[model samples]
Target: MGWLDRLLGRRRPRPIPPPLWQQTVARLPFLQWLPAADLARLQSLSEAFLAAKQFSGAAGLEVDDAMGVHIAAQGCLPILNLGLEWYDDWVEIIVYPDEFVVPRQEMDPDGVVHEYDEVAAGQAWDGGPLILSWQDSQMAGDGYNVVIHEFAHKLDMINGAPDGLPPLHPGMDREAWVAALDGAYDDFLARVERAEARGEEALEQLPIDPYGAEHPGEFFAVVSESFFEQPQVVAAEYPALYAQLALFYRQDPLARAQAAGSSRSR
Candidate 1:
């Protein structure tokens, strides 16, 4: 057994408290939109996640049961259909009270190296601990989910370097995945450039995060945030990409939202 398994006192996970599970689900509407069976599965997966990982609070922030469960709930959504084993390679999650700055150094084409601090809400290191800003993690609505965004990066890193493509499941086409993400990435990059030229209004009007234009990997993570929180927007703006994501995730969130809406209307 692994250290985590020993720490938890068993190989299996203990259940999350009923009230905490309900409260957590209520806070995340995308999770609440799930069918009862799926939601239960997610809860189970989250319990396993909590058992397998260790969470630490940085900047003097205290990590509590509620905070842990909340983060676990959101983080486990992407792997609800896939298993917790996808995340087994990493064991630590570090949380900050708010945005944290990381020093960065980059070399230009001319070989000039520059150093600066970059403020980030969340970060997933390749084969290392995932980091998050609790303040940003609370901003889960409107396609700005830091928890899901970072978890998606964790998924992307599973194969090797994150380049907008992770290891596809059996029978999934690599060329098709490339085509879908590449086509959308190119178009989105152009749109962001155009919007930047116009002003803040155009940038704010973007259906998805303009930061996605930073790189193909960032595009995958950003659109993944949209895929869960704002599925309809993804479905409408990039149907082909949405289809690919659904195939990969094995969950059709847009369809779930539509069905939930219809049920509520009845």
Candidate 2:
């Protein structure tokens, strides 16, 4: 049994076949960018994650070994250095065939309630199961990763609420974390507003996702996706925030990407 199986008192998950693992890694460029040692570590972490969580498919979809392995690989990346125990609170992962509708109700300032349906590609519930659209989960390499985005929210919720702040490490500065993310959040919100005023053309040019402006929590999740999938954009656009994330996640994706690029050039 793996460490997670022993810790959780669950049966050990079957190991991912070597050919399948290679095929899945080949399809994800960000995973391809990982150093050999880190890639091996990620595989081990993914196995533990699979052993610990239950996966169910919704809307007539079927969850297969390949699908489970793919999701586990991406989902475990953030916790690679942090450890599997960070995700011990949650046990179920629900996946839809495509974007799913969630019924939402809200009360306005005048105490009137409004109800509507919101379509989402992925969602991470507080102390509950994580949900995803299989279609969106497949779109990982270009920075719009629903798996990473939702998993990042899970990390944020580990402490209390998902308010763009996860519990910092012993040496990490909470004040600095707030300053960096808040400053970038404000700036990005302004940029998004301007893009909305100008039109869709301007919005499409944004290096980061405009949905990040929705909330600080959302910003943290969106940037976390970029941090792993497109580290160059985060490192170049928000150096301070990127540094904070590196410190929090305990991995330097930018350094890895740069090393890979230099290797390719040589």
Candidate 3:
């Protein structure tokens, strides 16, 4: 920032120290596939995210700067193309030592209400804090990243309830996105039903995580995680939905990963 801007109290973001940043990126292999420009942008977004949000650790866990930076790096990856303003609705991130149980209540279509405790690795509440299990967050890079999953939920909830649909940019075909996602969702559900009839082992053969078939909102999150962590699997198994996600995210992870691999060979 210039002197004049400083005089006006327009504080600039502090640069993320190289050592801290290198440590964070070293642990996240998926980030290695990002192009230099995109990697730099993700770094900037992660710094901004760290500056804007508050982090708290639960169950006797202490959230140090390293842990915070690591979490922020993964959290900011989804918005690498999209801006940080999309996450302005929430400012707090709560991390648990392990899986946490949340009390949930729901009303059935028949007008009956039910209550239960849901075990979750991560969760995002509309207009509220985003929660995660640090244990699950560390298990990223195996085609499942809870940080990305919860952040995806936040994105899905930006317009309204997260029913698997997030607000699309101008010129994006809403009908096309719906058809692709809904069609895949229905097909996956049918497959799961058939697998149940066959055996549990059959259900384990699903391309995408079986949890995705739980609901539309989860389908979006699960696929979003797969798009970043296992793009090839997602692209191959659900090309149409992958294309829709590629359009929405404005990045192609499969292409990026291939390019990264080619560069490594050189």
Candidate 4:
């Protein structure tokens, strides 16, 4: 527990009310595969999250308990096994009604400066608040999850700047992690380049989101979203990276999804 938590009277989190939890879990299809024990832990985590962080509505979006719980659930998922301590750095979440634009300035190699607006579904800052679009927040299924993408950035920023790499655990091999992610990232970029050369249709059919190839940090966030939402895709396309992620997350989403499939079939 941090001094801030104690000061704010948020050190001990109460359990999520059963009714709110039921409604939240029911609305979020992606959380259906979590084990019962894990779900219980997630409830506690959500409570802690709601207590520790402040949520603000933007652009006239009303932030309510249900909405807050939903966000908290998604935010807590990535850190379910990792623990809430990983997210101790930040304290606020700002949600817009839809996609928001932020002005950005970039300097060219020739020293020319360009300024423009970049539309974004979500953004995470180092030791700062997380910004998200409520429209994007409600669009999770198949492979898109704004909450996961932004929180994944939080994980990446734990050590320093947003690179694809997060702090490795004791048993995890850094060299192996580097080799796996780097090789997969290179291969993905080559695949995207080929797809672009072929056509738009080919680009759409690519195994994972091409946005991942944008940068190592984006790759980590994009793939993390895919890993949880569509683990089969990650397992099929980037088996090595998927394996490393499974090792890091300490959860086998592929196997869980397969089990769910079998249960539904029977």
Candidate 5:
């Protein structure tokens, strides 16, 4: 708790009534698309997340109720099947107004020291910090969600360094999760290589992020965007992938987003 937090009382925010909270949720695409009764439950879940978590803005970013609501909504989406307790292991959220540059040091394959840095939109280190860029955050849509990506990493890291596996709940089969994600990951890898071979676009409306092609851990995190932001695309092109995510997140976003998309198309 910081001096400002203690002074202003933001380590905790009192619960808004269910009706009012649902109205707050109605502003979001993911939330609003849920069935009305489910949306109400989501409101209760988000309220718990908001009350229990501490949010702080870094690098000249000012935290506020609206921002809290936004992050809380997205963060809670993944664990709706579980609870806010899914996030109980981590304690802080660090937000920046835009991208942040992090210095880097590495030894190349040649054993020569290399140093470089690049501005990143967001990053989530296991059991450490969840970092975000408000610019990309504010623009989250169409299955492109930085918050979901990083938080998914946090889930993946629950056991250790993100290896595309989050701690499984009772009765959930670990091998099944692994097999499903591995299949999708292998398919994405082949697509990337094929595109590279033919000099074609490698990431034209990919169901998962191109960056996910880097590693299984990254694939889990990036595909988490589809788990929340782009359920329809994933459901349409990768229903099994959608099914695996539906089991993990414990939410039926395809049903909701499909309904929303159908309404829009109609």
Candidate 6:
């Protein structure tokens, strides 16, 4: 219902892309280091996302204007370079004031124990509704943001399988992504187990985020949070992982954080 859109007799934008300023805001922290051209591209994509979707906070948390801005800002964060196109498949976003415990009952492999645990907030079903708890929306200790973690899962689900992999762009090798992530996943598991065994208080520390070792899928999601929020930590601690993610995401967030750090010192 825009003037130029009306002039062209267009209806509903026909999935037109987002604009540069929007993308920049979506990648707020990363914007500190993006080159002008790349920043503009991100901005454009964000613009299109705002134009295309209707965001609403659910439950007791009213989706007010400020809430809309916050949710849109975080929702689009995962797709800054990728654009908001992947998110088009889903329509609704539900937000809770704090972590919503999701209960699940599953049978173990041996078929003996039925176990259940209350886990933090999460996104669910493909293109369904992205569930989040604003309490953990901000950076947690070691910089784990639940909003980013769950949203990353949704992005991975774009290709119809949340196997810890999202659709890669052309010229990128799928096998490389697999190998790199697989190696890092194994290493992290071993490291965590060893730390627990040795009872090394310092060894018990997590490189990216301890939650990352929960599973391959969780590893990917957790690492992604570090890649964006605390890239320097991710890079210094997991260099190879950082490099591979750089190839996959087509962005150097760690470098960006370093640059931003340098500027802050001045």
Better of 4 and 6 by lDDT: 4
Candidate 3 TM-score, C-alpha based: 0.92
Instruction: Give the per-residue lDDT of model 1 (tens digit) for 144-263.
Output: 999999999999999998898988999999999999999999999999999999999999999999999999999999999999999999999999999999999999999899999999
- What digit string (tens of lDDT, one per residue) describes model 5 on residues 1-266? 53334423554545655554555565556777877777666667777777666677897788766676677777777887787777877777888999999888889899998889978988886677788888888767666788888889888888888989888777778888888889888988988777667654656645567788899999888888877877777777667777878877878877877787788798
35-133, model 3: which lDDT tens digit per residue?
Answer: 888888898888777777877788898777777778889988888888999999998888899999999999999999999999999989999999999
Show pairs that collide, candidate 3: none
Those runs of model 4 whose alpha carbons end farther than 4 Å from true positions after fitting are: 1-11
> Which lDDT value does model 1 have at 242?
96
Candidate 6: global Cα-lDDT? Answer: 0.67
lDDT of each: 0.91, 0.91, 0.87, 0.87, 0.76, 0.67
Model 5: residues with Cα > 4 Å off, grouped in runs: 1-13, 17-27, 197-202, 260-266
RMSD of each: 2.8, 3.0, 4.4, 3.7, 3.4, 5.4
TM-score of each: 0.96, 0.95, 0.92, 0.93, 0.86, 0.78
Candidate 4 yields a Cα-based lDDT of 0.87
The total of clashing pairs for model 2 equals 0
Alpha-carbon lDDT of model 5: 0.76
Per-residue lDDT, model 6, residue 70, is 46
| Candidate scoring better on TM-score of 5 and 6 | 5
TM-score, cand. 4: 0.93
Q: In candidate 5, where is summed lDDT lowest over 10 consecutive residues?
A: 2-11
TM-score of 6: 0.78
User: How many angstroms is residue 198 displaced in model 5 relative to the true structure, after the best TM-score fit?
Assistant: 5.2
- Tell me the lDDT of candidate 2: 0.91
